[model samples]
Target: MEQSFLAYLRGRTRSLPSVAVGIGDDAAVLDFPINGQPTAVANEPGSGVLQQVACTDQIIDGVDFCSESQPLASIGYKSIAINLSDIAAMGATPTAALVTLALPAHNATEIAGEVYEGILEACGQFGVAIAGGDLSTYDGPLSINVTLLGTVTDPWLRSGAKEGDAIFVTGSLGGSLAGRHLRPIPRIELATRLRQIATVNAAIDISDGFSLDLDRMLAASRVGAELDIENIPISEAAQEMSQTSGRTPLEHAWSDGEDFELIFTVGESDAIKLEQLSADELTTAITRVGTVVGRTGLWKRVPGSKLQRVFPQGYVHGETDE
Candidate 1:
């Protein structure tokens, strides 16, 4: 339903010439020309032009979190962290953020201050400044919206993957609802280091499930993927969640949402280089989970079984399949 609504919105919208990427990806990339010159020159240094990447996200009480149970500070931190994850996916340097809040009518002032404390904490950690935003009171659940802005020389887009490219993911996955969801560590520094090392063909943050987000990237790239089940990193949180969830840790790792880790594709040579990088160089571990294929859907291979089709499954707003 989210996809369907996005499709509808896409059909009705018309992109401007400055818009390099308008919709259907992690963020929108827009070209900002300097000194009345086109910034389309390839490999030109000191061109005084940059692509501005922008993305916005909203979190509401009762849906994203329960205000009564969860700490407001965590909620505020998460609002900024999630947007930073989007910027990380684009391999961009985050600059500033505009945050809007809809506070509850009762105790609105105190709640707003607590939320801002969390927001400011995250912003300071990331070197981002609070640009500007609006605030208001509402009878409905509290809602916080953040619009993040970043700059990139050449944005890593989702449509650049090629057949035979290797699929890589940073950090472990799954069981985000086990308290990891509120404090996401955005891969901004790691993504910057990766840009310095290898050429990322396509990239996306696993905000939804791994399978679902990978499927989105594959669809954008017009390619398919074949994942090695054994290679996928299942987190300890996933293992803990599996005990009573009646599901395998691998299953949770594959389908859980809000992992906030990056899933990117690279050529074979780059993949080899990345795999050879030492822990000190990477700071964070990256796993080669799969490979891009010429087909048009997702497939997975177990150790002893043939490749089998895997449907994209994850959290979708306004819908429930759990």
Candidate 2:
């Protein structure tokens, strides 16, 4: 579905010269030129030529949340957080956000206010502002959409990964639906600092399960990955949730969606530096889970076991129940 849409857009729109990065990346990057001369701005102390980046994301009431039990503010917060995660994947500093809400019939004004409160709280945390938005009425479910804009001096991309790079994930994975999904942090600060200290090759936020998002990064880079099963950081929530469930903790880490953590690749030397920095005062905890391989499919190797190809496809919209 995404591919078809991109294909259609590609046919209609011409890739202009000012568009540094286009569709299929985490966000679209556009260069700002002042009166025909390129305007350069420094987002970091010594970095140069920061360009504008933008991305949009949306969520529906029943599809993305339970309106009955979940707080209204949490719904609003998640809407913004998910979009900011995309900007974070580009290693950009978010500047502003525009929101659009489709309110269902009979929804109260106070409920909508609370949702805006949550949205503002998240924006304040990341130092971004609500630039503009639209509100409309709908007969069906409530929906929240957000468009995030930002700037990056050196944008990290999914296609920058090389075969010899090492794979890493910030924080834990899986079981995000255990309350974490409602208020997951965007990792914006951590990404900014991580890129300063280590060379990030490829990056993507794990929104549609770890395995699927990792496969996306690999596909964009035209490379493969070999994960160390023992090394993948499975969240404690995933472990506890798996105690009586049919799926194992590792399986949940691979396939449970909405983790919103950053899975990135870097050089082996940078990986070692990242491990050492994580020990000292790194903002976010990172775990080395895999290495980029020359092959063309995702593989996994448990301790004392041979590498085996695996297809741990994660969540996809429009999938019918069997």
Candidate 3:
């Protein structure tokens, strides 16, 4: 419903000349002018050409985190990291951020300061600056909204995927709720390295679980995916948690959101190059877990069975767990 509503609104309006991308994908791309003139930079290194990419993410108490259990610094760090993930999904370098905090009237100034410290620490790590933001007192829950701005000469989009492309995911997935959800390193450097070696057909930061986010990429590209269950990388934490949860590690990897890893598709040939390059560079480990197909939904094929349709099982706003 959220995607459909956004699509409807996007279809109703036309993009302006300066708007490289208005809706959909990880972030919106804008061709900002320099000195009051329109500028479109060529996708070349050291070309002084750049386009702006922007995205926002929000988190709230009770829903995103329990303020009582989680440290204020961790909360602030997460708020910024989530937005940076969106920027990184576009294969861009984060430049600045704008934050908005909504807190209860009884909140103390020290808590606010600690949150700012965390935000500052995250921004410093990513080479991003805190440009500006807003603060407001709310009667309800505490919420943090972050808007991140970035720049890329050639931004990767989710709509460019093609049939027969190889699907890849950086790092392992699942069990973020245990600890990683609070402190995740945005794959900004890894994404930049990916673009340097190969042509990434489609890309997205995996926050809404592997299956659901991959479904979004396929939907945008009008393609289908055939996942090899054995190839999906399951993290150590996921494996450990699965022992007590009665769920398989693979299940947790597919359904548990907030992985914050990069899921991208590359041409079959480029996929090979990417593997070799990553190995040589000692970059983040990536696994080829699937392939882009001709059909229009998500699927998985077993060793001996036919393709099986898979529905999204990730977290959804206003939707109860099964």
What digit string (tens of lDDT, one per residue) describes model 3 on residues 1-322?
A: 6767886878777553437777777998877687987666423322335788899988999989899999999999999999899988888999999999988778556667878888999999989989999998868888899999998876878887899999999889999888998999899888878877888878888888888889888888899998887899999889999999999998999989999999999899998887776443836888999999999998889568789988867876566653
lDDT of 2 by residue, 60-122 (tens): 988889889999999999999998899999888899999998987685576679899899999
lDDT for every model?
Answer: 0.90, 0.86, 0.85
Q: 38-107, model 1: which lDDT tens digit per residue?
A: 5564332123357788999999999888988899999999999999999999889999999999998999
TM-score leader: 1
Candidates in descending lDDT order:
1, 2, 3
The Cα error of candidate 2 at residue 28, in Å, is: 1.2
Q: What TM-score would candidate 1 get against the native? A: 0.94
lDDT of 1: 0.90
The number of residue pairs in model 2 that clash at the backbone is 0
User: Candidate 1: deviation at residue 252, Å?
Assistant: 0.6
Clashing pairs in 2: none
